[model samples]
Target: MDALSKSDPMLVVYTKMDGRLEEIGRTEVILNSLEPLWITKAMINYQFEIVQPLVFRIYDVDTKYHNTPLKTLNLAQQDFLGEAFCNLSEIVTKFNHSLTLNLRNGSGHALQGTVTVHAEETASSRMAVDMQFHCLNLDNKDTFSKSDPFLRVSRLSESAVAIPICKTEVIKNNLNPVWRPITLTSQQYSSKDDPLLVECFDFDASGNHELIGSLQTTIAQLENLYNSKAGANFYSHKGQKKLKGQLFLDKFQEKVQHTFLDYISSGFELNFMVAVDFTASNGDPRVPQSLHYIDPSGRPNSYQQAILGVSEVLQFYDNDRRFPAWGFGAKIPRGSVSHCFNLNASTNDCEVVGVEGIMSAYSSTLYSVSLAGPTLFGPVISKAAEIASHSVQYGNNKYFVLLIITVCNIYPHVTSVQKFYPSIVVCRMELSPTSKKQKILL
Candidate 1:
C-alpha cells in the first residue's frame, strides 16, 4: 500500500537478543517523499563473537493520525512499508564493507527499493575540533595554469547522505590555498574513528564548480599526522590516482572535564587559611577612610567584607572551621614589630574557631597593635610554608589556602613562597590600571 503512494518514510532497527527482536534506534521521518535521505545515524556496538541479528523496518507514517504509521503512521491503515532481516556479521564479512539487502513485504514479495548498509567504528569520547586544511598542486580544471582551490566538508549520516557542514573561502589563481580554520563538535562532526569527507573544488564565478579531488579521513588520523609532523596525502577518482593535495592539521586539543563526584571518589579534601595585611599603607584603623575602618553604624569595611565573603564559602570544606588568621607590618603591644603574629593575641593558639572568631580577633588586634611602616610579606608567607611543610611530613592529605590582604611591596618574597607552596592566589585590590605590573617566576 505504501509503494502505491508517496509516503513519509521512517526506518527502525532491531537486534535479536533472546529470540525476539529488541528495538535499537529509529531514523527521523522524511515527510511526503517516497525516496528519503535520513541524516540521522544509528550507532551500534559491534560484537564479533555473537551473531547479532538485525532487522530494518520501514514505515509509512499515517498523515491523519498525526503522521504516525498505520500500525504505528498508517499507510492508509497499512503502516508497514517493508522489512529486511540479516546478521550484522554477514555484512561486515563482505569484501566491499557494504551490503545491499532486499526489502520484502508481509506476503514475502520483494519491494522496489533496497536497503544499503555501511559499517564503520567510532570513538567513545566527544571532542571539540579545530581544523584547517590546504591543497597543493591541484589539477587545473579551467583554462588558466592555476586552479582556484576551495574545500567542502560533509558528514556521513545514517541516511547514507553526505550532509555538507562547512565550506572554505575560495582562493583565485592559486594551486595551493591555505583555508581558514573550522571548528566542529562531536555531534555534528564525526568522532576520531569515523571518517569525514573533504572535497577540494575549483571555484567558478558562474556557480558551476569543478571537483579537483577529495580526501576521506578521521579526526584521529589528522591528529596523528599533526603529532607526527607529517602531511596526509589525498586521493582522487575513488583512490585510483594519488592527488597532489594534502591536509595538514594546524591544531588539536582534547580535554576530559571531571565532575565533583570524581574528586570525592579520589579522596581529596580542602583546607583553608586566612592572611590579613596590617601595614600602615592600609591607613590608621582609627580613621574612617582606612580599609580596616569599623564604622559607628556597624558597616563593614573592605577588609572585613573580603574576610566574611571568602570564609563563608571556605568554611563548608574545613572540618573544624578552624582558620589561621595572621597579620603583617604591625607593631605588637610590646615594643617589637612583628609580621607573623596571631590576630587573637594568643601566643599558643593560632587557630580561630570560625569566621566570627576571626572577626573578633581582627578587631581586638586593631585596638592592641599600632600600624607599622614598610609592609613586609616574607614572614607571613614563610609561616604558612612551615605549616604546609609539617603537614606533608606527617603524610596528611590536605589542600592549603593562604589568603593575604596587604598593601605591601610583595616582590622580594613572592619567589620564596611560590617555589615551595603548592597553590598561592595573589589578589591585588584597589589599584589603578597604570600601577599594575606582572612578573612570572618560572
Candidate 2:
C-alpha cells in the first residue's frame, strides 16, 4: 500500500463472542513506521471464569484516508498486514503481564511479524492527588470580551499521545479564573514523573474552541509549584511562541485510599442483606406473570436470579454467611401491612443461615404473605442501617451490602434510603417485565 513511504499501520482489536467477532477498539495510525508502538489502549472487562479470545489485526491505512477518523475509516479498503490471536488471560497471567504472538495470514500461514500485547490493571491502585488550580493571566482569544478560560489536563503516553484525564469548569468572561479542586488518580496519571499536557482553552458556544496556551509538565512539577508558591508559564502549541499566561497551583494534596481488595485481604468482611419488594405492581404470586412466580421447570425467576447473582459473589467475602433477609410492602398473616417483616417469619431473628435459607424463606413468605400496595423502602433501609450501625458500634471490620430487588419504577422514600448508613452499600435491582431486562443501580 505504501510504496514510497513506510507503512502507516493501525491495529484493530476484537473479542470473539459466541463465534462472532465484535470490534472493541482501534489504535491510531502510526505514519511511516514499520514497527509501530501504539499508545491507544483497548480496555476489556476480564472475567476469571470464562475464556476471552482476542483478535488483533493490522492494516496499512492509505494516505488518501489519513484525515478520516479511525472509527469511520473503511477497513476493507485498507491493505491487510496479517493478524494475531490470543486469549486476554494469556497476557494477564504472564510474569510481566505481556505476551507476544506471531502474526499469521488469512490461511493460518506464519507471517514475518509479531505483535506484543500488554495488560495493566487500572483499578489496582487507589492513590489519588487532589489539586486546586487558578490561572494568573490568560491570553484573550475573544474579540469582544475576555476569554472564558478552562483547563484540561492530559497524560502523555509513551507514544506522546495526549490522553485526557481531567478538566476544570469553564469560567465565563474571565481571564483569571480559580476553578474548583480536581482529583487525579494513579490510573489516570500513571506516575508522578510522567509528562502531563495542561492546556488552557477559551470557551466558545461554537464547537471550535480557541487554545489560549498549553504547557507540558508532570505531577511532580505541579507539586513543586505549590511548594515554591510560583507559577508555570504557558506556551503556544508549538513551543516557538511563548504566551503571557501563567498557571498557579493553589494546593496539592496526595492521599492513598485503600481499595476494596485491600479491605478484603485485611480480614474485613462484607455482610449481605436482602430486601424483596412485595408490592401489588408485581402481580399475584400464583400467576405466571408475577415477578416472584416460582418456575416449575427449575429455571430461576428474575427475582431469584438477581438474589443468586449478587449473593453468590458476596457470600465468599462474608465469613459467617448469615444474611439478613426482609420483605417489604406485604401483609403477613394475622397482621396489618408490614413494610419490613422478616422473610423467615421470625419475630426475633431476621438473619438466615445461607443463600439456601434465603431462597426457602422467600418461597415460604410468598405463600404466607399477601402482596400490598404503595412500595416503601424506608423501613427496610432503616432495618439494614440499624444492623450496620450495630456492627460499627461494636468495632467490627464489616461492610454491609443491602440488595433490594424490585419491579417498580421508583421508591417513594428514596431520599430516606439514600441517607441511610454510610457503611452499607445499597444495590437496587429493577426488573422490567416488558423488556425482560434487569438494571442494577448502586
Most accurate candidate by TM-score: 2
Residue 1's lDDT in candidate 1: 40
After best superposition, candidate 2 residue 275: deviation in angstroms? 1.6
Per residue, candidate 1 scores C-alpha lDDT tens digits across 1-442 of: 4456688777888888989988777777777886687776777776542557889988876656554432343333538888998877555544444678899998889988788876644443334677777666677887846788888888877674778888889888888788888776776665667767888888888999888888787777778877887776777767788877676766677644343323433544456677777777777678776777789999987777767766765564465688888877888986678878898888987889988998999999888888885667777778888888787788776767777765544655666676667654333333111232222122
Stretches of model 1 off by over 4 angstroms after superposition: 1-244, 248-256, 259-261, 409-412, 423-442
| Alpha carbon lDDT of each predicted model | 0.71, 0.87
What are the runs in model 2 whose C-alpha is more than 4 Å off? 1-124, 158-160, 176-180, 205-208, 220-231, 238-240, 250-254, 262-268, 331-338, 368-374, 392-397, 420-425
Cα lDDT of model 2 by residue, 22-95, tens digit? 99999999999999999999988866435678999999999999999989999999999999998775565455
TM-score of each: 0.46, 0.64
lDDT of 2: 0.87
